[model samples]
Target chain A: MNTAQHGTWNRLFLAWLVAAVSTLGALFFSEVMRLPPCELCWWQRICMFPLMLLLPLGLFPLDPRVVRYTLPLALAGWGFALFHWLLVLGLVPASAQPCRRGIPCGEVGIQWLGFLNLPLMSLLAFSLIIALLASTRQKVSP
Target chain B: MKQKLLFALAAIVLLLGFFLASRLHTDARQEETRQHTALNQANLLRMHSPTLGPAEASVVIVEFFDPACETCRDFYPFVKELMAAHPGQIRLALRYSPFHEGAGQVVRLLEAARRQNRYWETLETLYASQQNWVQHHSVQLDQVWAALQGTGLDLERARRDMEDPAIAAIIQQDMADARALRVERTPEFFVNGQPMPSFGRQQLRALVQEALRTGGN
Candidate 1:
């Protein structure tokens, strides 16, 4: 394999590892810590869960062509995570806010273990995936 | 070729570092807010019960609850489970606020149930069936009358007590206590006289454990 091929494989593996860890970390935080997730957090989780499988599927064919398909998934996940993180940080107001009934999302403990809210962690994971997909690009003929 | 890999790795490291730094900033801010909330809780607890706990208990949990609030009903089971698990180590006090309209009767029925040594039972039953009464236009004497039937409560006395000035006074006192604490919600709690900033069972347990370790008042 050439240097570029080797680098692509390395980046893909690293990205998948990050995505897996982030997803598992989120599960542990919610289940073990008993931290109930809010609605936006739930949506972000839904968006990320599929990528956990999709990214690994991309690796099976070892085709750079897979990057074209995976890139959209990465971008979509990143968009959801970005929106959720901003909602958590009060950067953007939450759409379809779910606080009217029970413990408002804002009231739940944010930034556990120094600084990891559900959304920020999701953002980190999505960002890693995007970085990996971006790295796979080849220069196009003009 | 090696330089590119190193660059990619470096970028990853940098991004992770930025994420960690941002998280730390938010955590520090939340910690400060928690400290201020704790101080406010301390003042409120002092006004209500200066000593904090029963003379022999290991921890004290003070909850400010509104009878008609849906969230309070949702949180009731969790609190009950905590109390059951801790038993003698945990002392609990329920302060009532009739924040929602027509909650006064429910509060009175609860107090009457306490008089009969069935406070926990009736409280649990009421919470389990809160949906029935909370949606009604009026929870006056009729609601209390209906709630007492088949709950093993003395319906006649429960209804009589609903109109008792003393019952009204107790409810008023609870509202006053809630106001002093700056409790803005239905199910606010204080562990060892410190405001509970979060509602998860593990978080509540951790707070209680911290109080026990500190030899809480």
Candidate 2:
């Protein structure tokens, strides 16, 4: 209703944006690009897909408690994406990787900027969501 | 400044924990593999594995395919084309990969048909009618059975044979081989034990050609 409340709501919208973009990007990669998802990709999807629905439900009324729900999902997704990124870079050995067949664990189905691949992009998006969520927080005592 | 530093440090530790946990978990898996007893030959290819083309052909194509996979249905004709082109020079092996709901039941149907010496016909019929039954991630079994009427299958026999423990064992073996080979998707093809270099119609043709040249015999 007031200016400060409106500002808080808009800032919180970043969580919604991250969820929408990442979910659509995943669907586009699978449905449009015809790239099959590997096992880790599927795990990452399981984490990311829920936030798209959950974050938007918190909007309209624009509750700050949305962060409490969305941040846990974003963190879990970031963990999967981090492991996936390391696997892609061969930081994890073939013997130690979950994706040994089908599409392989280290495949870069898409890349841009000479550095951004799928997992990095996922990690970046999740990091932004977490940061945006944190920024909207009104100081907690311990 | 101190709060930001602490937040950054905590984030780093959380990430490190994930990475290390994955590494340790896979390390344990690798150790398990080293200790795994020799895999049974039956797991790799049962005596009853489905086949197309010649049984003793020089080139063997092992495709791990789920009955409910749309991609498998799409790839079916291409596989047939390759076999037709090569005549008796190539053999196509079908390994069950019932990764979808109701896919195991379809596998049982196919196995039962194999018992009646009607495996190829049943496979073609099921694929041709995949759209009618595979609805919203579930199989319409009654529709599938309806489509099978007057197809020369002894319907009563098929129903009885579907419950056979042999069929269960065959499906169980295929799933194990799929896990051992790390097959995560349907329509995965291996030509003479060599995985297709990449997934494409052209890549499949190319791999089959390479196999034919080197070991086609």
Candidate 3:
């Protein structure tokens, strides 16, 4: 209701923006670019896609409790993104491969700016959303 | 009132994004197909690439494949089945893409098997035991050799032949042709010198069927 509340709402909006962009980007890659998601990417999408819907609902009311719902999704997505990053980096062993068919998870499909790939991009987006939600949790708590 | 406005705005943006994406996809596909249409037919085949089915078959399926790619391995049987269904009417020519980390070695091994006239058997052996040899998206060369045991190939000769410069040249030539065709992924197929309208099993089968109906030998 106050200026401080408005600021917290802005952070929530920022989190929503990140989720929206990530969700749309994932769609663009799969639907438009025709790059099929591997199993790990699917798991991560399961986590990220919901945040795009959930976060915006919290924004209109400026609910600090929004962090309660969105943070979990962001965290789980972050975990999957981390696992995928490690898988592509060859740190995850072959025995753990979830993609037994279709596109292999370890195949680096898109490389932007020389080194940044899709898994890394997903990792960064989830990380940013988590950080934003964590900060909003502290500032908006009465 | 503000909440309704915000939700409506979000919906609009999402819908616009999806619409834009679909348009982009259509335009890109048209451009890609046009480019593929202009590609020289000679770029799609090589004398040295592994071929199956009757030599005089009117329908030729050229596949850009990676030995270490799982989809390529999985689709191998389906492609073989397609050729079988058509019998002598459909011929298959495999071009090595070898985009994976250790795939180059496996391709080299397969080429060596060709020297001993065991290319098909060696490829089958590798596909049957692909999981054992392909580790962390890279080919385990030793495991690949172990998997090839049932193929009755002379391993020593194959190994020595793997180092042959001519084999390397074959790989290089296939790769150059793959580039010419703009093949960025494994298991990409061209039926009768035509690229798939889109990439999938059904699309490949449909293309082959069309070819068979119109141009069967």
Candidate 4:
């Protein structure tokens, strides 16, 4: 209702939008395009998928405490995405790859628009969501 | 206020329904692509590749593998178990894609094992102890020979046959087929002439199961 709360709500909503879009994009790649997610990808998905719905549920009446609940998920997803991106870029050693059984984490299955691969896209999505959530938290605290 | 909240929920539900519906069409679309490629690219899928399982099995799994590749070694037992689990429904054709340095020598050794009617045994032995024989993505021929010894292969004869020009030609042909199929990595799989929509044991299993359901026709 207040100006600060209204602005925080906007940030929360934007973070929700990013989560929603990222969830759908992940589904499109895995379900529609039939690209199987690796172990790290699955872990990131676990963190990102719930925020899509949770954020909106929090926004229905505008709960300021929502940031407390969602921030951890976003941060964990960000970490996984960052590591996956590094692995894809060959910055991570092959010996350190976590996905030993199924699709190797290092393999770049789908590259879009010439340069953007799945891991990089995931990292970007998580980064945006985390950034939005961080700003929302800053406004909600005081 | 309640109407606005309901509307948003409905919109999300609608989008979710659309994605779920699209999933039903995915298999058909993939099957179409598989059939098209299978028909036009039969030559690329088959060669003098070594095969396992019954000759008339309906489902054929064509695998492009590097003998020295760690992932390929990791998958060998799993593939065998899958074939066994299906009981005459699946066949496997293995093509060499010796991408690792000095891997061709291992492939040649494997080819020589075929002459003594011990191809699969030798391959299994080598894969089981692959970590001992492959170092830093390169094949250690002496270690590989040591590993193969347990398979009862005549090492002297195998060494002599490893130099046979025919073995080199097989590797050359397989490498060419690998290139033609755009295989960039080891352990690439094609079930019933359909490359995995993506890499993963689960994906490969699903493709194989689908092929089995269709009787591979």
Judged by lDDT, which candidate is best? 3
lDDT of 2: 0.79
User: Candidate 2: misplaced stretches above 4 Å?
Assistant: A1-142, B1-43
Lowest lDDT block of 10, candidate 3 chain B = B1-10
lDDT tens digits, residue span B125-192, model 3: 88889899888888788898788775689998988999999989999999998888888888999888
Better of 1 and 4 by DockQ: 4
How high is the TM-score of chain A in each model?
0.78, 0.89, 0.96, 0.94
lDDT of 4 at A88: 87
- Return whichever of 2 and 3 wins on TM-score: 3
List model 2 lDDT by residue over B98-211, tens digit each.
887888999999999889988889988998989988997678889789878899998899999999999999999889888887677889887776666457899899989998
How well is each residue in B106-196 modelled by candidate 1, as lDDT tens digits? 7777777766767777877776666676664345545545665797877677667667787777777777767766666677878876766
Query: What tens digits encode model 1's per-residue C-alpha lDDT throughout A27-111?
Result: 6557544467766567667766666666656655455666676677767777877776666677666554555445466543666
Task: Enumerate residue pairs that collide in model 1.
Answer: none
Regions of model 3 farther than 4 Å from truth: A1-22, A29-31, A34-51, A59-64, A67-142, B1-9
Ranking by DockQ: 3, 4, 1, 2
lDDT of each residue in B58-158, candidate 4, tens digit only: 99998999988988988888898899999998999999899999999999999999999999988888888889988888778889877876567899999
For model 2, which pairs clash? none
DockQ of 2: 0.04
RMSD list, candidates in order: 8.3, 13.3, 7.5, 7.2
| TM-scores of all candidate predictions against the true structure | 0.50, 0.55, 0.69, 0.59
